[model samples]
Target: MAGVRVIVTLNFPSPEAAEQAVAGMAQAFKPVLQEPGALQYELFRSVDNPQRVILMEHWASRALYDQHWNKQMREQGAPDQEQARALSPTFEFYPQANYDLVDGIWQPLDPADRMTTIRWA
Candidate 1:
């Protein structure tokens, strides 16, 4: 691994709420429009069970990623904001691991219910 990739697994109160919100996110449709420092960003919904959501974020650097995570927008405002209210997300960033990708690509998934998953390596 070379750079930093933050893998955040948000545990919602229920699988249904998680599924509903994941389906409801029109704002999340575009990853490129997200924060500029994000080298890559992705979303996932558990296949066996829909409640668990995964977010993978690749940053220009670990420090940059840390900065982005600590910023008020992500820590405090992400929940209050309109695009994030439906999503009761819990986040975590790495203390170590320079997330260099061997293949440079992540898998993709499309669903009929309420989930969109994108991958980045």
Candidate 2:
């Protein structure tokens, strides 16, 4: 089975809010790095627009992703997510875009029409 890739864009009111959100999320999700099925978790900030942040997560399977959330919400009862959301009233979480890896190439799961080949420099 192919793995799942999740990308989310967060638009904050200010750079300070964006940075705070990243720091809180990183600390909150630190345990996710050891979670089963967790492949990659990366946070990025736009150079031009410091208030824009991007969160990228990869999981071994959709099932694992769902399970992770269920565990976090039900079993762990973590409130970091809620706190992060309170950072800014204008904080926005754009719809998450989920993709799948096909033979190491990433492609949108819904359409699977567009493909992205990543090359590390």
Candidate 3:
């Protein structure tokens, strides 16, 4: 994929922990806004389950996203992976896809037709 969208779902042990994790991630997001190739970053709280939190990020490329993740942000006052793990021990990272709106329609940016069909389970 030329660009990538990463979706991460974190399942906290409690609602309080999930809220705390969101606060920590809000702080962590500051540096990401300044980082190159960081297109968009958003955090969502699950209405059905208060203990669940989701993070969606759009990057110029997978390599750039990897580079950003590789950086140590603890010294910069951002919560590190260990701290996040402490808050939410179970997390799920969805497969990345490159997609965008073209003429107000959702379309794959890359040549591959990975999202050609919508499968409803």
How many residue pairs collide in each prediction? 4, 0, 0
Give lDDT tens digits, candidate 2, residues 20-50.
Answer: 8789888866789799998888888999999
Better of 2 and 3 by TM-score: 3
TM-score of each: 0.52, 0.61, 0.63
Query: Model 3, residue 29: what's the lDDT?
Result: 82
lDDT of each: 0.59, 0.72, 0.74
Which sections of candidate 1 miss by over 4 Å?
24-34, 72-121
Write the residue-wise lDDT of candidate 1 on 16-37 in tens digits.
8887767765356464336556
Candidate 3, after superposition: displacement of residue 25 in Å?
1.0
Give, for candidate 2, the lowest lDDT window spanning 10 residues. 87-96
Better of 1 and 3 by TM-score: 3
Candidate 2: where is the Cα deviation over 4 Å? Answer: 75-121
Residues 35-73, candidate 3: write the lDDT tens digits.
898888899999999988888888877788877877754
